[model samples]
Target: MPKVRVHNVTISLDGFAAGPNQRLDAPFGDGVGWGDDLHSWFMSATKDAAAGRTGTDVEYFVRGDRNIGATIMGRNMFGPQRGAWEDESWQGWWGDNPPYHHDVFVHTHHLRPALEMNGGTTFHFTDEPLETVLRRAFDAADGKDVRIGGGAAVIRQYLRAGLIDELHLAIAPILIGRGERVLDNLGEGIDGYRVSELVSSPNVTHATLVRR
Candidate 1:
């Protein structure tokens, strides 16, 4: 069975995953950028390649090309804003060659044609239910795990639905006082999740969670 996992997601100490006014210029919000944090995390995660210290972080961040077959992201995560895309010309914020080199699915109410970008990345827009999108992503992954590349809301949905098998959260040291809160509305009983591992790096704290 293919497991659904969320990895490399950086959240602020204030529990905000992203800033409120997210736009093309301010993807992660004003002054709330994770640029340095992300760079540091990626560097550390990839550092052990020479030492053969393969771990979960290395698998998801450094060696993602090996394990990741497909990715699923919310509309906001796919782009800066929401609603029907005004311009079909807007590819994404990641330029002609975005990061993920595998199949990617974007959840949206409005449908758009599949976008083929540089490299092997292809963005598929689907308005179907979450389950449908998950199924498609899993099938596309070819038995490999499907990664939930998110903007918080998407992760919350999957978490509430109990569809996610594993979660790796990179807690950054900074605090965004008034941004999008990731765990705001999480109801009680969500405590079924238990922390399986904790690692502290210079830039962020990595926490791994699994359902109890």
Candidate 2:
């Protein structure tokens, strides 16, 4: 069976997965700023690679591309755009060739036509129920793995429904006083997972949780 997983998602020491006061100026919020400190671990991965730095950090970061045939993400992760499509001109945060080289399903309340990008990445937007979108994503995966490409809210939904198979988080040592917390509404008795592994680096602590 294919496993649904999350990889390298950063959460602050204060329990906020992403910072508050989200806006166009600060997508991850001013306190966070996409890649200042909280997400610098991830932001540095590719840059470090280009600069000829290869180590555990590079390996862990690049590992996200492995065995992924399909992915599901919330609209927020897609871009800063919200609500109905006032304009369909926005493609996404990524350029023509996104890192995702497979089918990517984006959850949205508003309908938009399927977008085909370069490098085999195609974005499919949907307003369907969670189960419906997940089932469709699993089917599209074709026995391969499906990754929950997230914003905190999306991950919360799957976590609450007990639909995720594994989750890997890179806990940043920094603190974001306010923002959306991933584990906020996880509810009690939702603890069927065990820590699969823990890897520590100077910048972050990586923890893997796998369903028992």
Candidate 3:
């Protein structure tokens, strides 16, 4: 079966995925103490491998892209904009060719025409409910898995719905005092899920939560 999976999601020691006050300038957040330290490991992975960077961080980061046929992300994760998208010029932080070479769905209240980019990436903006989007993603994925690329709120929704099959969280070393929390107020929604694996890299600790 095709699984709904989340991977390489980095969170601070304080359990915040991103700091408050997100804007165009600050992708993660604005004026956070730790800044982008929570994602340092991820940044390293994007660099040339000749940099001598290796270990669990690189291994797990690379694993997130494998066998992912479709991707779903919140509008915030897709871009820094909020509310109505006045400017359609923003094609996401990733350049002309995004890393996701498959169909990518952006969950938002305001929908827009599908934007095709260089490479095989196509951004489909939708206002549909989570279930509907997941259905479409599954159809687009064919037999492959669908990845949930999140910014905390989106991941929390899937967790509340008990729809996520696997979640891989990277706990960074630093702690931001305030920001968005991914695993907050889950209640019984996460009762069926448990940490199946745990490993610590030099920069961050990895925890894999699998549903029972």
Candidate 4:
């Protein structure tokens, strides 16, 4: 069975995943943004050391090439909200090439055509239900795992639906004070989830939770 995993998702000490006012300029939050907190993780996750030995942290950061077959993310995670893209010109913040080289699905209310960028990455927009998107992602992933690359809201939705099999979080050392909290008003706590692994670096602590 293909597992649904959420990996390398960062959060603040105050439990906020992103800041209150999210724009292109300030995507994460005020002063302390996602960039600052996630710089090490990103560098590690995307770095290919052999070429020049990018960074040591990359060894800790997880990649999709292993068992992951597809990726699913919310519209907010795809790009900064320019208020419903008037055109498909925006490829994303990763420039001409994106990190995700597999099938990537973006959940949105509005529909847009599939975007094929450099490498094997292809972004598909869907206005369907959460379950529908998951099904498509699973199919795209084949028999490998599917990653839910989130923007908090998307991960919350999957969590509430009990669709996530595993979650890997990188707890940063900053405090946002105010922003969009990841675990808010979910009614009851996550029943069958428990921390399975914990690792730490100087900047961030990585924790893994598995569904029982």
Best to worst by TM-score, what's the order?
Answer: 3, 2, 4, 1
Greater lDDT among 2 and 4 belongs to 2
TM-score of each: 0.87, 0.93, 0.94, 0.88
Rank by lDDT (best first): 3, 2, 1, 4
- Which is the winner by lDDT between candidate 3 and candidate 4? 3
For each candidate in the order shown, give its overall lDDT on alpha carbons.
Answer: 0.79, 0.85, 0.89, 0.78
> In angstroms, what RMSD does candidate 1 have relative to the true structure?
2.8
Clashes of 2: 0
Error of 4 at 99 (Å): 1.4
Candidate 2 structure quality by residue, lDDT tens digits, 3-47? 898887889987788777676677786578777788888888878
State the local distance difference test value for candidate 2: 0.85
On residues 32-140, what C-alpha lDDT tens digit does candidate 4 reach at each position? 4545764456555565544455343455453434698899998888887645778878888787788788899999987889999898899999989989999999999
Q: After TM-score superposition, what is the CA distance of residue 45 in candidate 1 from its true location, in Å? A: 4.9
Taking all chains together, the TM-score of candidate 3 against the true structure is: 0.94
Model 3 Cα lDDT, one tens digit per residue, 53-129: 76777888878988999999999999988898897998999999998999999999988889999999999999888
TM-score winner among the candidates? 3
Per-prediction tally of clashes: 0, 0, 0, 1
Worst 10 residues of 2 by lDDT: 181-190
